[model samples]
Target: MLGHPWAATELGPLPTWDPAVRAATDLVLASPVPMALTLGDELLLLYNDAYAELIGDKHPAALGRPAAEVFGEVWSMPGVGDVIEHAYRTGEPFLEKEATLPIHRRADVAEQSVFTRGSCAVRDSAGRVVGVLTVAAEITQVTRQLQSLGDFAAALAGTLTLDDVARVALRYALTVFDADRVSFAVDEGGGGWRMVRRVRGELMDEADERLPPLWRRGPADWPAPAVEAARRGGASYVDDGEPLRGIAVDRHDQKVRALAAVPLRAAAVRGGITVGHHDPHSWSAADRALLAASAELIGQAAERARRFETQHGTAQLLQRSMLPEHLPDLPRLRIAARYDPGVDGNAAGGDFYDAFQLPTGELGIVLGDVAGHDVQAAARMGQVRAALRALALNDPRPDQVLAGLDRLVTSLGAEGATHELFVTVVFGVIDADRSQVTLASAGHPAPLVRRCAPDGQARATYVDVPAGAPLGLGSRPVTRTVPFHPGDTLLLFSDGVVERRQQGLDRGLATLAEAVAGAHSGDPRALCAAATAAVPGATEDDVAVLAVEHALRPSRSASMEVPAEPTAPSRVRHWLTGQLTEWQVPETVVGAAVLCTSELTTNALLHAGTAARVEIDLSPERLLVSVADSGTRGTVTRARTDTLSSRGRGLGLIEDLTDAWGTDPTVRGSTVWFEILLPAG
Candidate 1:
């Protein structure tokens, strides 16, 4: 600048400069700080090498040019222009921290730089303010890194699942690393891998319809750096020379110039996380440290989520395995049971139910709650259920069954060296003739009975069974006989079914009774569902419920499992014809019943795509037949048949032939039934 003509034109020859101008110029040029001297009324810019590098590409030309013309874009920003003007006018020094300047590195590229900048008025020999002298230190990298980490930590704190951790980690990695793509892969415990990747702000995955779209599986060997990191048990870096593989974000052969991969050091899970850049870049010490810290956080979160999932799944499987798989499908009684685990905790709670046939042709029903949530509780429940079934088989009396269970529970508590056992159970015996049910309770909630009167109105009331001291404590339980006749349904359930958090047990019981009364009384499956669903929104403890409906069974009652084949409907028709003829049913009634039942069976097999169970109950006055399938599809509603146009072609025949017909949705699938009036007695 000293020998340049432009510099000489702006401030004269170096030998002719004023004393103060020369001294100020020496001070500005020698300073290590980024200092710029804007001299005279025109405010021509002069700066040291440090300041020249800060202003990129405008150095030599900016040497003898006005500060306003050289930095017009930056000078127009809010903090830059106002602070400089204030110091120039008042001659008072000023300082600003974290001031933002939008700098253009090239014609097509722009960036925001933050700095701690200070400015003071420059004076001539006459002591009059001429221009502003500014000094600044850039702090953009440190500031942005801190801000991004704060946001990343806040986001990670709310994650409770592996998928949540992957989503959050991948999203923030893009910002922290400023990379073109980021990927998170998890080991499938086998030899496979499931990966979720985000490239250029868009997530990439394989076109798989079975998996969720955002997290579709990727090729196992696509991310070579991540796979290598996992294999090496350490972080991996690739500055260049590694070609990209796997599913590309845009085209088949997108290139990557740099990569960083970190292995997840989790105890229960093994995987790796990676970030890739499309342009060549070097990984600095600070960049490697940040990536390792992020990987640590992800590993810890993944371990926590996997532990929870493993415990929860194991507990649920153990509890369900202890309970009955298939209930007794009887001719005189219809039985159904349901069990729902609590919403909180991973331990298995003490709720169980079972229905089995006794040696004397009677049915034994039991529901119990042993007091806690843990493996011990589930084990204790299994003991109680097994003991009760044994006692009922030996005596076939409700009160005697409870007495034997009391002894067994007392012995169990004695065997439990650390904690005493507390159990409440309701044991009932349904007579072989379906005339009545004898119930005995050991400090358990009374069983409920829903009765349909001659007027066809159903009412639900709790059976007045005697309550005694809970098992493990000494007390005698008395038996109460309730008239569980035809069209009357009995419900036995654990306290979880009628005890809610923040609500009284009485209110929950009343709500259950109302739900039972409103449900169809003839279908035990529907009754059990309604009773369990009476209290909404995630029960705090496990729920176990059993429903038994006493159907009017005369001399002729039969059941058959319908196969999913073309011959199923014809076989059902032939079987029904023989059964009705043997029972002395009239030809007209038998013909109509056979035709309607065949159509119902065909619908179940065609639409449900599963095996169907057909049950028939014949009385002197009417014949009732039903077809139930385990599939959830093909449910029929009355509105569907309100008009012939909307009714299914097969169901229209059922509606025309039967005296009364309807459909009841069950816990597993659905049941469609029709009643045919027999000839006059």
Candidate 2:
């Protein structure tokens, strides 16, 4: 006896079922709720007499039909059948999902079956999903009500003007609830309904209805200020609005009958709403809920709109302040970068880019975000960005720079600021000679790099440099670096570009990579603009971008011989790997010597450095790994220890990891330095 209007007689004879099926069908028919039976998978509907009452005029013929035949064209749209299938497949009831039911003047369907918040699937006796038990309590009332409220919410979201929400919400209540008219006013200090909207009879203008500073002791009003203040305090009422005391425009006041009022404030200020009707009528619970929900939605939407504006302003200002006026004069390279907030108002929501010259003359570039929207979020972003710039001067290492930025954010505390606030940053320093670019980052978006053939005859090949996370909110983050050849282009960006809601960071990054894969341009700025433009602008978050192309130039570059290390191959390998990665070397070459470096360095340390100091130096031509000890003599002979193992055997392994090995007697100790000309391929 499902709530379906159709009856068994209208459905005609159902197909003959097995004896067990007939008994089960009988039991279902005896139940209190409206019930239905399916002829196989066709979902043949069966309605008991109690179910027939809800349909009023339409029944009998409506029985034994697929839902598609019952609802007609609405079934052709998306999601309806899928929802029903999901319910049947899982044996749970589908409840209160907003769908389009064919019986209404609207498209939204609000099912009222007894599932929790979503669909409750119905199951067979054997625990397999067989059918769906659906009960629609015909909340057309609630549906229309909430729809009007949603409309009001939409209007509020588009506006910054204060009165628009009240006007829209009032109008919604009138139309959705089928009331004659609902009008509202606000009190701008002593002025009543300072901004107003209302519906009236054919000859009357409800918006024009006004009263002076009249005070009445009745249920509806005292004065413009008191009534409006009460309303703004989130107070509301239902009343037979009539003048029982002091008033102006006494005639209309007498004509007005009932009223309802609620607070107009949605985001943190006092606003008021009032609805008027000429006839006395009782409102249903659904109507009242719609009234309240609409007002709330309107208020919240207004706040969201205002916040979007603020963040948008902040994003624009930050971009203007952060991006360089033009690309720097990087030798042999044409560098350009483009940045767009994507959407005008959402620009305030956290992405930023910067390229600036540090006092040391190193080119410092950063791309980052603070991860939220609003004026406060933007302010925090500004603080972190400025702090990052200052901190970069102290260490300038990509990891260290981001660490400092993280510490900066942790130190910022407001009594009510959202926690888990962190920043992600990628920072890089272009070498003075422009031979190589030293890059590092905390958790952040990675930079896109493309190296042009030094011969200038082939197309530029792209390289990827992925750094650690953005600034803030992590105890420890992975450190990363990549070497750059002359004429290499490194394109940096923020998360706003190519990002989608709830899809995570990887998708955006993948899309970005694809955008750059086939480009042939050397102008970083033009390329950047075109690349950024290809990303979807529907993003709610802001985006920041900066691109740098490293080009070689003639410049003096030198590294002093001031280093030491253990001589074991394993130890040497570990130390060299750490130092080289920190200094940003090629990943492939570092891997080749990884094992060899450890064995050679350990051998030198065991037989040297104990009596003096150790020295290790890395240059473009040769990697000099040495160990000096205070001992008067250094030897290349195999050790005579109890066990003649390679631990103290000799410097024989040095010849293995490197091309040659030697020793030197310095002023303080005998120094042994090995040299290996790095291979060229």
Candidate 3:
């Protein structure tokens, strides 16, 4: 009243002010809540200290100014200026909750504020209203905190892996708590902890998905507070770094003045999360509640992920152990196989495949599937595969092999008394002369053949072998013969490859035929890879594929396993030269073949990271050579000018000296082959 010139002009001298105005001024000054009094026609503003804080920097200067001038920026905001005007004009009191006010706290941006406020008419002793009195309680911070917790719950619900849970929890904690750093740690059960820490500067924009914040790991200097919370199975807090005194901390952690830790509420796992601030902060009840809720959500996600990882690991180990480690290597016949488990990783699949040489020098191929996806089913599949191999070794006939298998399956079913003991299989035998393939099916899907014409065109056809009842049902299998000429590929697969949840088996079979016809028909490895990927989406059942190509064994052919060593390539060169010379091959052809074979061996050892198999077939017209490796380094391609570079010179030599060259990618590794045509006699 003494400092403002407006006080003198608007309400006369301070000592001579109206009794009612004086009483109102005294009331405003005494209240703790935000309050303001607008008196007379101009609605001249008078406010207490609590109300001044709401106006920010406009406090001292707004003593006796008009309401519109004092709050010019936010006076027009809804539920503010309009509500006050209505109370003053109609003499009616107004109360509103969650009223929004766009108050300008910064020069360029307006801060949104939510408040529960009420305004009532201020009347003189004459019983006539002259102004409005407003009282407000800001709930902005509380409302925002609740909204953030909701978002955190929604985000945690979709996380399915341990890494996902850690990443999301750390990011949200750093932002929601306004902390300098956030850490998440899980007890690894052996005195070791896997911890991830994210600092404030690591936060990324919401729209950028390419580069996520850096997640640092390890047990280096674990956060002492978080570990303590996990051990106690409760929350811990300190406002002045009291708990961190005398504890081992890095230079960055030395700046933390406040810390809060919440233990994860998982029943099967032990872990906790911690948040730290650079400046001293008193955690309110709302803050503690939010932290506890967040920790609960994280705990649930982590438990689910832990269970899934355990089951998936067990299933994978069982599936791989039941299958063959390596297929039989033949001189004139090329073989490749593929196996993939179903989407449900918790159960071991019953699909199986095998190939071995018979006592009569013919090759035996078999594929089968049991009826279930469990440990029992996988065990029965192994029994069936082993029995078939033994039966085929005794007699190389396809029908006889299946007949023995049928009896064994029937006996196993009777002994075990389980429907899952029944099985479906296709057994085939390739004659030593490579003239034809004899196959027998026991209630199994028909095998496909990719026949290549002399004109270089190819087509796929399903063999019309008569089907018998599935094994264990006591039906006889009939053997059928198909002409297996050079460049023809035989594809045997389990029904899982052609069974889809959304389509019929016929459509899936047709789709597989089209995919096989379009594949490289001469390369069995490539065909196997293509056939496995023929179905687009997630498969409900496990898939197993086997492809064999007939190369027509020449009068002279040889094969050897090249070791993965520096001297392996040199040995290959020497061995190839000697073999060609012993076969009386032309000198020029021997020189070219040796050079090409050496380059391939060297490339395989360098990139494949495993032992490689090398095979060569020579006839009067051409020499066919291939290098196969079990490592996953697949096909290599180069640009037009890359042939002469040091990194690509191996391919350069092959391209220059060979009549034709290509690469075939298989399930486990790849095959690179080149052909050299000799002069006709």
Best by lDDT: 3
Please provide, for model 2 over 1-681, each residue's C-alpha lDDT reduced to its tens digit, 9 standing for 90 to 100: 344433343333334334444555665567665455443465565555545544434466656677666556645655556666667665656555454444422234534322112434444455554445554444455665556666666666665433344445545665665555444443343433333344543222222111111111223444432255445475545555552224323444446566566665554433444555667756556656666676567657546544654555455555445434444554444444444444443344555666666677777777777766655566676777777778777777766776677677666743346576767767787664545666666666667775555564324333344554455465354444466666556787776776777676666666666665544433354346545655654776665567665544422122222224433444455666777677554575466445444543443344333423334444443454555455322223332333333443334444444444444323233445555555543
lDDT of 3 at 651: 73
lDDT of 1 by residue, 1-681 (tens): 675564445566677766777788898889998998776666777899899888887777788787778777777777877777777788999988778787765543567888899999888788888778999998888678778877887777766556668778887897778888888877766766777677674522221111121444445454555665775779988788554655455542277768888998777787788888987889988888888878877888778767766776566557767888778878778787777666553458788888999888889999989888877788888889988888888997888888999898888887776446889999999995858899999999999999998887899999998878898788589999978888788999888888877888889999999988887444666676678778765578878788898876533568999998989999999998998899889999999999989988987876566799998877655787989998644236343233333125456678778766766544455688887767667
Report how far off residue 211 is in candidate 2 (Å): 42
Q: Candidate 1 — number of clashing residue pairs?
A: 0
Q: TM-score rank, highest first?
A: 3, 1, 2
Q: Order the candidates by lDDT, highest first.
A: 3, 1, 2
Model 3: lDDT to the true structure: 0.78
For each candidate, what TM-score against the reference?
A: 0.60, 0.36, 0.64
Against the true structure, candidate 2 reaches a TM-score of 0.36
lDDT of 3 by residue, 1-681 (tens): 456675455566666766776677788889999999887777888888888888777777788788888778578777778888888899999998887787655444678888888999988777788778889888888788788888988888876566668878888898888888788888776665666677677434332212222233335346566766887898988787655555435655777778898999999877899898888889999899989988998899889878766675465556657677778877778787777667553457788899998878888999998888877777788889889998888887888888999899989988987665668999999884857999999999999999877776788999999878899888599999989887788999988888888888899999999988887335665677678778776687888889998864433669999999889989999899999899888899899999989888887777666899999877555777889888645345532324444335677778788776666544456678877877767
TM-score of 3: 0.64
How many residue pairs clash per model?
Answer: 0, 58, 0
Model 2 misplacement above 4 A: 1-344, 413-419, 453-466, 473-483, 502-507, 535-537, 551-681
- Which residue pairs does candidate 3 place in steric collision? none
Query: Candidates' lDDT values, in order?
Result: 0.77, 0.52, 0.78
Lowest summed lDDT across 10 adjacent residues in model 3 is found at 206-215
